[model samples]
Target chain A: MTLFDSLAIAWTALRSNLLRSILTTLGIIIGVASVIILVSVGSGARVEVEKQIASLGSNMLVVFSGSSRGMGGRSAGAGTDLPIAEGDVAAIRDKVQGVIAISGQLNGSGPVVNGNTNWTTTLSGVHPDFATVRDWPVRAGRDFTPQDIRASAKVVILGQTAVKQLFQDEDPIGATIRVKSAPFQVIGVLAPKGQSAMGRDQDDVALIPMTTARGYIVGKSQVQSDQVGQLYIKFDNSTDLKDAQEQIETLLRQRRRIQPGAEDNFNVRNLAETMKARTEVLSTMTYLLAATSVISLIVGGIGIMNIMLVSVTERTREIGLRLAVGARQRDIMRQFLVEAVTLCLIGGLIGIALGVGAAAIVANAADWPVVISPAVIALAMAAAAGTGIVFGYFPARRASGLNPIEALRSE
Target chain B: MNSVAAIIEASQVSAPVAPQSAAPALIRASGVSKIYRMGDQTVRALDDVSLEIAKGDFVAIMGASGSGKSTMMNLIGALDRPTTGHLAIDGRDIATMSSDELADLRNGTIGFVFQQFNLLPRTPALNQVILPLLYAHPRPDDLEARAHHRLEQVGLGKRTDHLPSQLSGGQQQRVAIARALINNPKILLADEPTGALDTKTSEEIMKLFGELNAEGITVIIVTHEPDIADFARRKLVFRDGKIIDDTERAPLKAATAAKDRVL
Candidate 1:
């Protein structure tokens, strides 16, 4: 018989026992739905982490001077490494082939005064390339030119949060604000960036030329090491990040003359790597949930097998009748197998619809992005069919192996 | 012409024996026995039985409960293999044919009707009749027409949409008969076909069988009731796993029997 004909017959049988058929597929429904939800949630988390990390910066590396010890786990204390100077920055910029931009930074924080308002925020002294390296474009006024860095001009760029607190409704560009009684002219307003992974507001900061901060804001140490606290390096793209990071680290080590056996006083951190670690943690959680889903799938298959065995027993006389009418053993076997596959496929389709719907509702509620690709759908379908075959085979074989004489006599 | 001679003269149902030669038997059994192993002991269902049924002949087998009549029917139906002898239907050796071949023999050559009608529950009459044809390869395009024709032959054409639960016992039996005839088998095997029907319905069913037999289909019925067996031209009675009596008589006309029911 044609597969379509067999499927039609199987469908009729299922419809005749509609309630039993539906109950039989409940296990499959729950199994398939849970699997789909787990996969979507995992991918959603990865995407979320990538987004948060991308906001921090893409294809970017932060080079921290001194040992890796801090309140936040990465940033180094100022004046801790005297050997990491502006010359090491120049060497990395010149030697690293994937380098897109690089900047030197010296940092401190203090209260900024404007008219009657005063707000405390981070103050960072950086070269002209700092804003572009961090993907922090200025929103208004004008960028501080290279001449400003060379001449130690007291021009400053205000972050969005700092502007909001210090200026309120007024345009602060070209306005002068005092940092610890030292007057600084606001050259531009930095664009707004949201919170960091650590829940810190990223926009609560100010940027000024490194020369000005070294001389006036955060006065230079007496050793005259020309030391900048950190360096930010941007690569061409994410693909080049690893290679560029390695090149920068090697160039810095060579310029600083650090021995191979000694632990270097600098640490190069890839922002994407840290984000990937968080993604791995999320993926582990997904696997744990997926494992539970798999157990349910097997349990569902067992249910199908149990019900199919019972069906074969219940329809023993029917099997005999078909056999008497010249249906081959294979035909009897195919009939039951088709019934199982039909049940699973229908249940799987419903599960997929339910999973997608649930994922969409949950994602929207939690403010997460969910991707439902065709591949995942196909996998679910294949899994359902496979489950049918694996579980249905035994019962089908039992039915086909029945002696017609004996079967006909079964009540 | 004698009744036997007349039957031999007009036979067109099965086998390819020369007209000038004696007609080869449609069913031939030689010393066929069926033994059942129940636990450690054995029970002989049939023993050393030999018989020949010519094509287009209507025969009735009668016996008590332990007389092996049902066992004989099962063997004739090809539902079981003989223990130590040979049985052949349509000139093919049943002893040597594989299970698949036996199934084909049953499918193409024999039709079976049970006492209970055995119509699938909740299935409409038309689909129940179409079950046999589904297994026929190179499936005929006129399947629905064939099923309808058989239902019409059995006088159930108007109730083709009725389920077994909705039909009377007689109507259900008619439906089963239509299903059996749908494949146009050479022989019809009815086991106590009238056992479950009332007298009037039993007469009606026998009348239908009589009509089919007149159309050149061989008919074999296994019944304990002598009145039901009276409709067949030949009769065999079994006792103690053996045929103890065999007789031939002019069959009772079903029309007269139906008329007698009113009187």
Candidate 2:
């Protein structure tokens, strides 16, 4: 028989048992849909994470004080017998290459009073370069200047949430707010940053000059700086982050007189490493989910095999008739094989439609960024087809190996 | 009269019978044997049998149960291979032919009608007839036209679209005959073609077979009933896997006599 005739015959035979054919195809449908949906969800999550990471300012790095001895014995809250003085910032700025900006930060939780309004928020002391390093956007008014830090100026930047809580509908950019026991003018209002995945209130904070924080609140001096919390470093690009981190670690170790092979007390965290760690976690989760989802595909394959075996048995008479009419064994095998593959291909098409629709719906409902890649679509299609061929082989071979006389006699 | 009597006596004494050599022989078997093993015991189905059937001969094989008549039919139809001796169809030794070659020869040379009137259930009469044509010639164009023509020849032109289930037993057998004849085989082999039919239907089927024989197609009928065997011009009876009697009958003077009797 010609290819066309063979296909026509197989099609007719399959259609004769329409319900059975549909049930057999259901396995492939589920398998293909699961594969596509799982991969889509994984890619969706990756895209969302990439977006969040991008929002965190790609060039920024966080450096906390290490437990190394320096000029001052031990700074307050500085655990180390050594202290990371304010002078180290200047030294690093002068020594490090590709260093764009550097800043010192001190965090303290407190309540601020604006007229009749009072809101508790996190207060942070920062140098003039803090805004540049952290990519902090000033929505209104000006950022702190070098002169302000030098003179211990009473000016502060109110985060979006802090401004909203204190001023409500009124503009609080140039308003006065009391911090600790002293009144300070609000120099700027920062933009809203929403909440992080860990449920941290990113916008509930205030930024002030380091000098004013040291003199009025903490009572520390710039030259002898007894307390320092974190140092924020910004590099020109991601490529320079590693080199700068290593150079800074080496400089700090040498300055503190630390020996080789000793664990450094300071933790250097660059956005790239944090991004890598986050991606690793997301990838592991995706892999686990994908592995679990693939179980459905295997089950579906088994279902296909079972149905194909039944089909082979049910069509024994038809197969025998074909064989007796001069049909080659290979021809019978090809006919069954084509039927199986055709079922899977049809199922695969339906599955792709269902999976894409489902993913789109879920992504829209959860407000996630979903990117459906063509490679994933092709992979799922190929996997479904491969499952059909692999699982459909044995039963087809059994059908081909049947004795014509016996099969015809099987009624 | 004396010479004629002497010639007849000498002929009966020397050869018992002399087969006509004018027509070419289509099938020749020499000491063909078919042994079927059942469990540990072996049963001989055809024991060292020799037979010759010439072209355009309508032959009937008659036998009781376990007489190996079916085995002979199978060997002649190329459906089964002989275990020993030479069995030839159209001068080609089938015992030496490969399975594929036998299939090809069967497709080209033989058509079979089974006792059950083996018309595939649910298939249209037209499709049933065209099935054999699918095996003939790699390309099977004009199958519909050929099937229609064959069905018409079998007096089933209007029932071409009707399925086997819709047709009566005699009509179904007619459809099977049409399928057998569609390939224009050299020989038509019918195994109890009217076994399942009523008396009248059986006579009608026999009449159709006689008409086909008249058209010069070598027709072989295997039957246990004397009435069914009477339709053929030549009758061979088998007993214990061997031919016990072979006889020839005079041709019917009028084909309409059988048709009128059926009516």
Candidate 3:
């Protein structure tokens, strides 16, 4: 028989037992749908992490002061070593080839008052360029000027949370707020920055000129004269951030007079690198889910084989009639094989629709971004056909091997 | 031979019949025996039987159940190979033929009809007749037209669109006959073609077989009813795997009787 005729015959047989065909396809549908859905969610998480990394700062690096060495020889928490000095910051700023911007900050918390209302909030002492290095654009008024930093003027920038708490419905610009009983003029309000990966409200702090805080707000320093606790640096967009971070670290080592082969006292943290690491983690999780779902696909394949076996047994007489009518063994084999592949293809099509629908629903319900790629659809379809061939062969061979006399006599 | 002589004497049936032709037999079976093994036991279904059926011959094999008549029918139909000895069709020895070759022979040279009509369910009459042609070597290009022609030839021209379930028992048998003739084979082997029909329908089916034989196709029927056997020019009787009687006589006028009642 022609291949077309064989396929037509296979379709007719499947149509005759509609309920059985549908039941056999259910397993495959579930397997493909679950695999695609899980993979999509993983991709969404990877994208979310990349966005978070970009939010922290693009092409940026944070240099922490050296950790303290205990008497027992183990390192202590960061900032225990000598704090970074203004001269060291200026040296790095002048010496690093790719250094585009530099700023220093000292962080602490205190009660700030406006009229009868008082709010306790963490405050930062920083250069005017700190806002640019951190990508924190001011929403209402102007940023602190160079003159403000040089003269150590008592000017301040309020974060969104601090503004909401102290100002209520009133405009905070040009208003006077008390910091440690010293009055500081509110210059601007930083735009709201939502939350960080650590679940902390990022917009819950204040900014002031570093020179003012060092001379008046924070009192004296123990580690060094005119030292800031942290240094923030930005590199040109086209320059590789890792290269800039390495050049900065090496310059710091030489300035600190650290011996060769000794562990560096300071640590450099790249937020982008951490985001890439999380992407790797998400990829591993997706592969694990794929493996588990492949097991389910095999189970679904087994279901197909079971149904095909039953169908062959029930149609023994029909097979004998075909054989008696001069149907070749291969013809019979191809007929059943076609039936199996048709079943899987149908199931796979339904599964693609289900998976896309599920991804959309989850995206809406959980408010998480989801992506459905063509690669996923192609993978699902190929798996379905492969499953059919691998599982359908044995039953088809059994059917082709049946003896005409015996088969006809069976009924 | 002895029983043949005895029946001839009792009926005083006409003078000894003349051989139809000098042409070689279309089917040749010599020393053929079929043995069945059911686990540890063996049953002899056909015992060293020899027979020849010439082209354009009409034959009926009659015997009760377990008398080995069905076994002989299967062997002649090329559906099974004899356990011992040789069988040939149109002078070609089938003893050494492979299963594939046997299938080809059945496809191009032999056709079979069953008692139950053996038509595929849900298929229309025209499509049913085209099934055998699908497996023919060099599969025909004009399949629908050929199937339609055969259905028309079988007097089913008016009901070609109806399913088998919509047709009468005799009509279903006619459709089966049309399927058997689709490949234009040399031999038409039928096993109890009217076993499921009423008496009047049986006569109509027997009449159809007789007409096809008259058109020069070799026809063989395996049946247990004497009245059905009356339509054949030759009758062979089997008992316990042995041919107890072989006789040939003038065929009765079954087609006329069929036309007088229902046609």
Show how many residue pairs clash in every candidate, following the order shown: 0, 2, 0
Candidates 1 onward: DockQ, in order: 0.53, 0.22, 0.52
> Model 1 segments beyond 4 Å from truth?
A50-60, A66-88, A91-100, A105-125, A130-145, A152-229, A234-266, B1-23, B255-263
Order of the predicted models by DockQ, top scorer first: 1, 3, 2
What lDDT is reached at residue A185 by model 1? 92
lDDT of 3 by residue, B185-249 (tens): 88999999989999999987888887676555788999999999988878999999999998877
Best by DockQ: 1
- Candidate 2 clash figure, as a count: 2
**TM values, all candidates:** 0.81, 0.73, 0.76
- In order, the Cα lDDT scores of the candidates are 0.82, 0.77, 0.83
Which is the better candidate, 1 or 3, if ranked by DockQ? Answer: 1
Clashes of 3: 0
Candidate 3 regions exceeding 4 Å error are A50-61, A65-85, A91-266, B1-20, B253-263
Model 2, TM vs. native: 0.73
Per-residue lDDT of candidate 1, residues B107-209 (tens digit): 7888989887888878899998988888776577787899999999888889989999999999999998898898889889998999999998898899888
lDDT of 1 at B102: 79
Candidate 2 accuracy as lDDT:
0.77
Model 2 over residues A124-160: C-alpha lDDT tens digits?
8888887777677788999889999889899989988
Q: Over the stretch A128-191, how does candidate 3's per-residue lDDT look in tens digits? A: 7787788878999999898998899999999999999999889999999999789999999999
Model 1 residue B210 lDDT score: 74
Pairs that collide in candidate 2 are: A68-A82, A69-A82
